[model samples]
Target: MLLLLSVCLIAQPATCRDEQIPVGGGAANAFVCLRNSQSVLAQWQDEHPEWHVEKWRCAANAAPPKKP
Candidate 1:
């Protein structure tokens, strides 16, 4: 019966069938594929109060931020 026992041991059930790709501490890899809609793009003429500031928008109902 050693052959049967060996086969049983070798056929142990697997926990998952997904291909594991290590990303940010187990967090899945994701990216946003959206166009950057804006009014215009050009060089700023003068430095103003808000000139040094940067802005970012994630659609109002954007998904939660993924792990870093």
Candidate 2:
């Protein structure tokens, strides 16, 4: 489990992606992508209990950006 977690990396784009989501073609429900990160975080945690992805918003493969 740890190995799997270490290999998979998930992160938002540098600029981030935002879009307006409409339910039933803008008839019933409304959705926003401003902070959809929480959902992704929850999924990672549930998928990998052996690893603590919840601690960081990124997967284990996330290494610190190299210095110039």
Candidate 3:
């Protein structure tokens, strides 16, 4: 029973979003989901020192923001 429960929990899919990240001075666009935004953003900043974040927003029906 314990093993079954663990498997079920692990199999559950995480909620995510199609987040838009501006690149190349707003002349281009990029996308990321909730599950990877943290690491993705970090890598983007490191690789593109000149790029800046214009704004970030969740795609339709994406994961809701966590409460404080």
Candidate 4:
């Protein structure tokens, strides 16, 4: 039972997004899976030091953001 519960929790869907500085001098949104977000973002930041992330957000589902 414990193993089953752990599997189910691990299977949950997740989405992550971040706003990063673009070369044009404005922020651009980048989306990535939550599980690999950190490593992916780190590599990107390392390769493109000028495009540092400004903000980040993660959610459990793929649902689109609600309109304000």
Task: Give one digit per residue, the lDDT tens place, for model 3 in 1-68.
Answer: 00000001113334222324422222222233444445556775576454443334333333343311
Q: If both were scored by TM-score, which would come out higher, candidate 1 or candidate 4? A: 4
Q: Which runs in model 3 stand beyond 4 Å of their true positions?
A: 1-32, 58-68
For model 1, where is the 10-residue window of minimal lDDT? Answer: 1-10
Instruction: Write model 1 residue lDDT over 14-52, tens digit each, in one string.
Output: 321211112222222233211211211111212222232
Once fitted onto the true fold, the runs of candidate 1 whose alpha carbons sit more than 4 angstroms away are 1-33, 38-50, 61-68
Where model 2 places Cα greater than 4 Å from the true spot, the runs are: 1-34, 54-68
Estimate the TM-score for candidate 1.
0.16
RMSD of each: 24.7, 13.8, 15.4, 15.0
Give the range where candidate 2 is weakest over 10 consecutive residues by summed lDDT. Answer: 21-30
Q: Supply the global lDDT for candidate 4.
A: 0.34
Give residue 27's lDDT in candidate 2 (0 to 100): 26
